[model samples]
Target: MRRGVRTEEMQEQERSKSGLLLRGRLAKELGQHDEAAKLFGEAAALEEALAQAYAAQGISEQVWRHEFSAAGCWFQAGNFLRSLELCDKLMATPDAPETLRERARSYAQTLRERRDRLWTELLQSEHTLVAA
Candidate 1:
């Protein structure tokens, strides 16, 4: 009775959490950076929970998919380090689909390149400012 009620409530919470991912995407599309980041963070947490559940059930495909999604969301949220961490995890996941692993590798390379380019731009800007 009480346990059943609690389970229902928990399920409802999970459903609400899942909705954040879609909302985050919408916010991102709208260029609402702060809101998008917050929503994406919430959604990433839910994705992680889902990943754990899938792992418990021995569902490797779902686990990797959720992990990849969460990583992407973190990247969109400007959490590059976290995104890279998850990307590395995806790459290291044994028995994961080759396509997914390749995607993770590609994403990691892209992120690194983007970071390096941004760093160079920042340094160049700073040098110009110092010269002035």
Candidate 2:
């Protein structure tokens, strides 16, 4: 109930949100897709909680980063089909920005191509090994 306590809580909450986003970004950069996805999911959850808090406080913009995190998770996991589906869904969602949608689309396309090429190479390698 103390004013100083409330201020401290708000600051701590902001720091927590920022920390989650930073951790997720770092994980993704390190090519730790599984870890990145978990971090992103955690970040998204925190953002959703913050959004709900804002809504309760009568704020218009409930800024949640779930879509971006989810899209990144799918892309990082090499689940190109899922990534594409999510990208399309996010594109249609009013809360998702056009820039985010475009980013998702780009990532989805890249993942799909990469997955296809990798599979083809793997098959060829297996065939060669069998013959040998």
Question: How far off is residue 47 in model 1, in Å?
Answer: 1.0
Cα RMSD for predicted model 1: 5.2
lDDT (CA) for every model shown? 0.81, 0.61
Off by over 4 Å in 2: 1-64
TM-score of each: 0.79, 0.50
RMSD for all candidates, in order, please: 5.2, 6.6
| Candidate 2: tens digits of C-alpha lDDT, residues 1-132 | 111222455456657867876887898899887887776666555554554455455442333244445455555544566556666765666655677767766766776788899999999999999999
Off by over 4 Å in 1: 1-14, 129-132
Pairs with backbone N, CA or C atoms under 3 Å apart (clashes), candidate 2: none
lDDT of 2: 0.61
